[model samples]
Target: MACSNLGHTGVTYTGKEDLRETLYELCQSPTITSPTGGDNVAGYIDGTEFKFYKSDNLARPAVVNALLGKAKSNYATVYTNRADALWIKHYPKMKVKLMDQLKPTEGDGAVGVTLALQTVKKWPRQIAAIALKAPIPGGGLHAAAAGLSKDLDLPPGSRKKGLARALRYYMLATYSLVDISSAEAYEGLKNYVGALLVSDQGQILAAGINTGSFRHAEVSMLLSYFRNNPTATKVPENSVIFSTLTPCKGCTGFLSVTKSSNCVIYFGQEDTGKDGKVGKKISTQLSEKTKAPVGRSKEKLPGEIVPDDTEDTEGTGVVAMGTASEIHKVQVDKGLTSCMGTGSIATQIGKAKHAKEVLRSGSEALIHKMLRTRATDAESEVKHAVLTHIGQWLGTSRSVE
Candidate 1:
């Protein structure tokens, strides 16, 4: 894995914590002084290092072109906290020209800068947009979680348990962001998985979702980890990874190659997809090879408690409470209904309908049908469950107004 090398004025930050703090500081800094006028800042990650450009405005095409002139690869990711309208108008043209310059055989090279525009004052509106797209009952819950990202404080002495619950919440929240209709149409809701990588101390290293054809959730998470860490060659030992679904064969291979953590926990079993069958067998093989504990939690309904004397089953990798001895009781919110199996009932129905549509009229018709009949109620309940669990772990109460 090629990690990004951080560089700003010849200063380099080593380690993941340092990189995160430096990035946060850079984002908050007001003294950099943009040459063109406002507090706007623009930078690009060119596979290797991040280069910041100071300008009164967002980086113009000329500036970006100049930066690309000396770049080894055509791919890069541009980050800017400038006016949104400007990027909205400029991004298409920039993408077109950049694509024209891309090499057909460009393997593992920066493809082109994908613009990540963040406006300081429009965060509320951004949150609102996410809420609007979310299921009705979950809109407020999503907004609340979005607002509380910076205020996450795990209770003392229960940090590990809190972190495990937090990872589950993170996984669910990420999964909720998937466009269910599109997923049902093309694949299935069950296939749209999410993954999280956390350090031994409970720091979230990275998160990834399986949205595209090529990038599995685990592989996507590792790629994100490398991008953020920049210096890390492998996942830290004793680190824990949580995934919404079992790791498929490709993801297992990638995890093995990356020397990912031994402890992997999944919420859902493998589904009936092309790569799904490879999950358990490949994971068992990997476990045998690495001599690590690869396990899945036994199926339990919401609020169900495991017996104190329950022990982890050998070789099968069955564990009651993942990476923890004691499990904290999560308080379920009022008026929320529980759905059995891996995900919500809406997801299960969506998956069944998708399969039916696939057999009857192919994916296009399935997509059309899913778009027509949206499963908002069940989806909202799922989101509420995630928010409730997260709030319980953080020693707080959360609910949608």
Candidate 2:
């Protein structure tokens, strides 16, 4: 596939297969303070972090990131982050939209197009405490989300149906990028996801990405972990599962059966047609709206400091809040940290002994097992902090209990 950026046609994709399916994900970022001293260029995927000198080299170091197949995902972050540094402004990359098309060839003429890169101008990432990707809401949030719990008044006429709908259902939203292929298998490098299961009070439960045996669906693997694992099974029924992409009907049904109230998908709705345009279009619209973080808008609820409705917009990345250690605790460090609400988070843990064995045995199939363990911890640390802050914010902002 030919990739053209800024209207400059350059670089044909050099790979065996082009991505057949449209991909999506949700990026729940912990708000980091802008680099304090200077241009401190760093990037992290999953738990691994990379530092770079040249902005262009940012993508080169991302070889360690598990979810990103090639250099592009990290590269996009670097490109956008560095651009923000240079401009002295925050510009967030909302999403990467891939479009495939056929162009003229010399002799064989028509070639099967595999992959093309498109940068969505409006999908922003924030230091989110509770980011539910295209998530299905739990009893409370689900009721709120379905416009069942309360009356929702949306702005009228060409206001973007998605933006209004999201605001009506939620106070916050974020996004992610994914690589989709025709084959329904994980090929070590593509068609996987990064997942985290977190409670409303901010504790890590289970986390995994589509790796090893998990090539096709992350939601299934996450559900399996929650159901089968001794520790995760105890997660509060009110807890929510976060996935980088939207879950299929089967997986969503499974989540429903498991009694887990919410499964927030970061990406798009599943496609109804064979061509897959409908879902992709909706994803694009939602991402576009989420690219810029909504602030002090007319959407704010009465007597609230922040808006009643929080949505994303295009072209703005976020800075994480909190201290360096606090940032790193959840940002990079693995394995549970700090009590959430009840202070008995330690008791909430699954079998720590069994977790150690998974790490020690260290087989190929068990790679994701260890990954799930550590990533779950890492995501929980940050998410808890984020949730804690959100809780505090809600307390201070809302007069009623």
Candidate 3:
């Protein structure tokens, strides 16, 4: 195998070798599974030589020792997360460089992994195509603002503004991932929807996307949150969840059972069944079941209100002012969300076709629009927040110098 050096410190140029297969093998190997009873493994690739490491957890000494002892210079390491995504970390410094989720190409289980690997290996050059800088249609910022204003026709207030801002972030994150998926030639990129669990303070707790499987976007987001914060059993109170498309029945049920968020907001309504009616009904029922907090007045008093320092927002799933959380359905014009939801049925039909090209073009266009769009202080803040949330998955710092 010919390996080209990209002239960058931590970037590994493995000429035309799709390492997803090797990653899947290591993940399923007995060494990693026997010790941890889980399919978690790590691999280091130097030249044509591949070294596999097994660890029960991220901090396992055996894997660390393998990396420290064996890896010397110019190598790439890959690891599998709880979400079955393959993350490539450049070695020597050990910073995550890239990642791709293993799709069920052939069948549901391990067979899918095999088929996906084979598919990637077969079209290495195509998968390695460079991203094109394309123009976005309808003007990125203008379209986004117009969509939010028209869709979420709520009384002008902070809540409406906040929801609109969060939706922008969600759309950006979703399109960004789609761009990556397109670069990697992942099938069904158009059907991808992004989900975010955000705190009342506007910090993103966890970010997730639909894997085109049983794990919907909402479910994946919750899983990522719990994986990152193992001690957290449920979502924090006053936290909101934003989904690019309205969740299905399965996702709504999971969110309700888990008490996933105080408020659930969605951009595009799903065409299946009653649009967002089911989710709204379920969320309303949950909110009604929740009792008002004691000692806090449900109605606002006419006097100057002092912030309560002792108020618990941890596990109570209550909103401020002793009110229950609500579900909001934004009515977006035919836009990015609709584009994303298309070809989902095709994805379900044995991957017969995908919307990768459409999604990639759309994503690039949106990105271009965003770049050309004038940036307000608030827009800058939202962009920074989105970058920070994505940075959690893609490491923030470069590999150790």
Candidate 4:
């Protein structure tokens, strides 16, 4: 949620102090004097005081605020109260034509792909919020992504190029750099992207440039830029900071499996030697910590926001086999797994929660069974009633199974 400082009527008052100061300033403003001299001076002063008092009372900050109401408006109207209100002026909307072009035909795979493309192409600004990954929507964003491979006439392992193209378009759209349909802009886009991808500045460039030719000096230049500002090899935990050389045990088997056999520990900015540190022999997993200040130990306790989304067992890495803390670590690690592990989000969502609710309802293993099963009229009515009840509790209109 974005916060704003000013209110309507172009007033600069935010709260108590600003309101008082504004009122004081208004009071000290130039006063009108009587043209008729001495006799009318007192009357003029009285009239001025009355007018000032009336205006102050009528436009009192509390009253002005009460009339304004909570903003509760759409994104377009959201940032009007901020000090730098004009910054919101440049925000672009989803291109209506591009969106119309993506309208689904019978809602099949092509439609899905078109929708994904349209979505990414239009509001590329949203990509960061959703995380900088492929915008594969329902039925898999990758399914349509293959179209790029076919369109480019590339062979296997050419998916990355298509992915890169999509990413380039996405970045440009997000920054409002240029319109995608312009041919010259697209060509420039190609060169710019080529430069960024193989450059040391890019994370994927290091692993991807083995096959491409070296004619493009832009690629090498980018590689040099990345080398200078090398991407961090280690991502910090969300909530907690891992102190150097701390013997933090793995919470679960998955925690142990997620890390490489050798872990690299950096203290401040420098990597120091910790004799016989766990990273030297075996991989050590660190649980996420709060964003500092919460625990104050630099080490956050378990349950900090995991960097990765929990999806399923397949890519869940190995579960740690140790004490309760180890098991807890595994549990936390599972939360870091991606949601794209399996076919259905419902199933994957359950796995993300460790199948706990599913097991409690005896619905974990029964997912397939429930899908295959049919309902009688009476059962349907009862299910509808139950769904309604649950929906009321959840403040949703979701159908119950």
Best of the candidates, lDDT:
3
Q: Residues 5-102, candidate 3, lDDT per residue (tens digit)?
A: 31223434354345324433433444344534553444444444344333333322123333333335343443333322211121223433111343
If scored against the real structure, what TM-score would every candidate get?
A: 0.33, 0.27, 0.38, 0.15
CA lDDT of every candidate: 0.35, 0.27, 0.38, 0.20
Collision count for each candidate, in order: 7, 41, 1, 25
- Please give the ranking of all candidate structures by lDDT, highest first, separated by commas: 3, 1, 2, 4
Ranking by TM-score: 3, 1, 2, 4
- Report the lDDT tens digits of candidate 2 across residue range 1-401: 23311111232333234321111110101111233322222332211212122122221211112113324344333212233221112112322111111123321113233233332221111112223232212223322223322343433322232223332112221111111111122344433333345444333343433433212233433433433352443335544444434443333433444435443333322233332342242222123232212122122212212121333111222221222222222211022213212222211112122211111111111111112222133333332334333333222221100
Q: Please state the error at residue 225 of candidate 2 in Å.
A: 5.0
Q: Ten consecutive residues with minimal summed lDDT in candidate 2?
A: 21-30
Please tell me which model should have the higher TM-score, number 3 or number 4: 3
Clashing pairs in 1: 36-56, 37-56, 75-110, 75-111, 75-112, 76-112, 76-113
Runs in model 3 lying further than 4 Å from the true structure? 1-163, 175-191, 274-277, 280-358, 361-401
- lDDT of predicted model 3: 0.38
Candidate 1 residue-wise lDDT, 153-260, digit = tens:
533333222233334344433333222222322243244555556444434455565544334566556656654454665776655565545576556656654644
Q: What is the lDDT of residue 130 in candidate 4?
A: 10
Best by TM-score: 3
